[model samples]
Target: MTRKLNLLLATGLTSLMLLSPAFAENMLRVSYPEDPKSADAQMTTDFYTLPLNIFDRLVESETTGPGQSALVPGLAERWDVSDDGLTYTFHLRKDVKFHNGAVLTADDVVYTFDRMLNPATKALNTDILTFIAGAEERLDGKADSVSGLKALDDQTVQITLTKPYAAFLALLAAPGASIYNRAFTEAAGDQFGLTPETTNGTGPFILRDYTLNDSEMLEANDDYWRGRPKLDRLLIRVVSDPDTLRMLFESDEIDVFDMDFAPTQTPYFYGADQWKDHIVSGPRVGIYYYNINQLKKPFDDPRVRKAFQMSIDRQTILDKNFYGKGKLEDGVMPRGLRCYAPAEPIAYDPVKAKELLTEAGYPDGVEINLQQVSSWSSRWSDMNQIIQAQVAEAGFKAKIITTDEAAYLAARKAGDSDAYTQVWSADFNDPDNFFYTFFSETGSKTRGYNNNDPEVFAAIEKARGMTDPAERCKLYQDLTARIVDTDAAWVPLFSLDHSFVVQPRVKHFIVPWNGWSDMSYYNVEVE
Candidate 1:
């Protein structure tokens, strides 16, 4: 029987039977709050939990310490950059092999880049690859392949960019840039990530079995170049209910509980004497905020936007909804980025907010739908409710709309909502990654922001290409001020610290700066 069919047939069995210590001598069980949108690397931002382990990129991120990471060689051993910094030549590691026993080569690297950049593929993150020369042509459907990608030999691949980008290497280290097996991917066709046969790669783990919306069974790749994983099997259960997740962990049914912990219940785990040594926490490299669509009514006016920003009690929300585990900031840039700076403190002035709304021709106030994905995180729903109440006192009626992750993302992309709350984790550590992804002309339009500001966009575009480090940093600081103070583009919230509780038996587990999405379990040991 094929692996897909076997998984389907076994779906009826209880997870306890399959994950028990008696059945699998060495297994690490974990919980995810929701089912990943897609297992395909290029197709998802929500499913990095799977792809981070199931595939290897040209380069990989190493977690040096809390809120810190450095790029290291993955499939590619090393590379050389041209003097002008436009060209990058990467040397392939000869000992690497895909899950299907196919050799990893320069041709595979070329094919991966071509597939991701192709307009026909509808890859969600092609924006990250636009810096490559000829990428615009391919994405515009004017070329069959990326002209800048070349396989010099069986072991070497070269990529040329339109301009010098300091963050180009950091972009390659993103989950979307993971290398794929050309032959296997081509043969799988449209069913690539949906089926077991097509989700193959050259990483530390293999997709042994997957049952949609319930669980994913992964096994260690014995042929892993770095070393065989200490654990034999990794069983990730899809447990959405916070109560159920806590029950599983306390009963020893799950080995690790990280991002799935509810904010309210954190005090329980923190105060417990037994769980003290098992808990790990650190600052994350990301932002949590509300995305305001300028095309929408009421928000189209600058006064309304600024009023909306002033209406919310950000510090109160952090304390009550998030258990005061995060640090509040007024600017969009989070703490871990190099360009981070302290801005003027935000005020929660309902009277000022009412006056601004009155001046904007809405003396009676306005009603807006504030969307949230409750399924993604319960704490978010609680936060949205608090926002709804706070805004009400400022002469605004905010209706809370809830949806699932997949639907929420689709609506956000289509520009279908008045306003919504969301979190954006860094694809890479560069300041350019944050500014360019959320504020640039293309980024703003595609994300349904409908924002138009030539000066801000021009500054962002220039910052990405400057080779001098000090100049680039200064440009970023100016852009941050304009986006936050002048334009009021989005409401800045707190940066929450990432916390995880692991079983005493599980040791050396690394907590990534970006939280669970960037976590890798290859180096973790099970006693």
Candidate 2:
């Protein structure tokens, strides 16, 4: 009887061990090419905004659907929009606390916006705040305070807008509107945005450890306002080389990989009988193009700019570099977007280009230098080389200048380059951000290019001021046709398709239209 009892006990112990949960420090590792420059939520670059968007928000929800797109119960449970559509009254969630055990309140929200609008903070999205009644004046140092913003009580906050901006809800979704812990920012001094270690926000994860050009580690925030994250830990590794990233994915070193795979190479991993089940592809919300410096000589002439557009073989480039994974972009907006139009793009004609160059007084073949910043996925060095060869075929001697990523961005921002590649991802489901920024006189002009064309500017203004969605779409379509036909400031290249390879064990991974792969809903289920 004693022997039988011992045998039963041993059998029960073995069964319990087999059914036990995976406590081996569950971590979901992701690999990407670039490292984030800062954890500062307000940075305009996607590097900072991507992670910050996942970590914090004033309101969050999807667009292009029936759901309410804006100001939907993030830190604030509900909010009231005044009859005039100017004042926003927010009712804060009662039982919410920061990662550090401090209760979140209206004071924190007020502090976050005040600091964001402060000139000293140098927030990148200051322009977005212009909708606030006195935010523009305050940011310009013409006002004593942001009179449009006020805290009514510990649980209520009110914001006043100067006008009924159509993209206001989308703007709120941006990182510039994220609420930050006052204590953390004050204590970190100058190093606050550089890493997640010093920065604290009301999110589901906290930055535990990170090494530049190496890896980042995030641990779940048990005190998150919504609830604790399912995964105990998240790891992001920086693999600057795409080839290496692919190899790592094949070797199973990383669980997920993103980037368009070459057609020739796809069969090896994504064969019908092999990894087909793991590969996923979808449309992305991004525009890739070359910006022309309008301030530069020759290119300043619209005819010369139009001639340059006619010289490049966009289809060939897309086929070669993108592996036919993307479609040629004729305008700023891609197909499937609300405002997209099937307009005519400049055809490749060396003779016409030469004639235009001669007309611009560069008869002996214009000598121009082109600069392209290095990117991990695009292999920009190779792309520049091909572009050089193509442009030379059109009687133009082109020189390619390459720089490291950081220096390249600085030069582009300072308008120090004659021409450079640019990519813009939509912040919201609007065409205004797309066309306005690239062509508007006041928007980012890394290329030093400005339309100055009265008709073009008027069309953009009309679209911006229009509140009706159908009217806005029609105006934008007309604007896109004008820009493409005139070759106003850029050469629209191709719209890339986002690709991702995930491990079979991962579930509920969603790749949204914005190219944001939301990992919050992801969970691991062991086979």
Estimate the TM-score for candidate 1.
0.85
Candidate 2 lDDT tens digits, 258-346? 65423345545555565778876666767778778776776778777877788888778777876766778878786545566766766
In model 2, residue pairs whose N, Cα or C atoms come closer than 3 Å (at least 3 residues apart or on different chains), thus clashing, are none
Per-model TM-score versus the true fold = 0.85, 0.78
lDDT of the candidates, in the order given: 0.82, 0.67
In candidate 1, the residue pairs with backbone N, CA or C atoms under 3 Å apart (3 or more residues apart, or in different chains) clash, namely none
For this target, which candidate reaches the highest lDDT against the unseen true structure? Answer: 1
- 238-264 per-residue lDDT for model 1 (tens digits): 888878888888988888877434655
Q: For model 2, what is the C-alpha lDDT against the true structure? A: 0.67
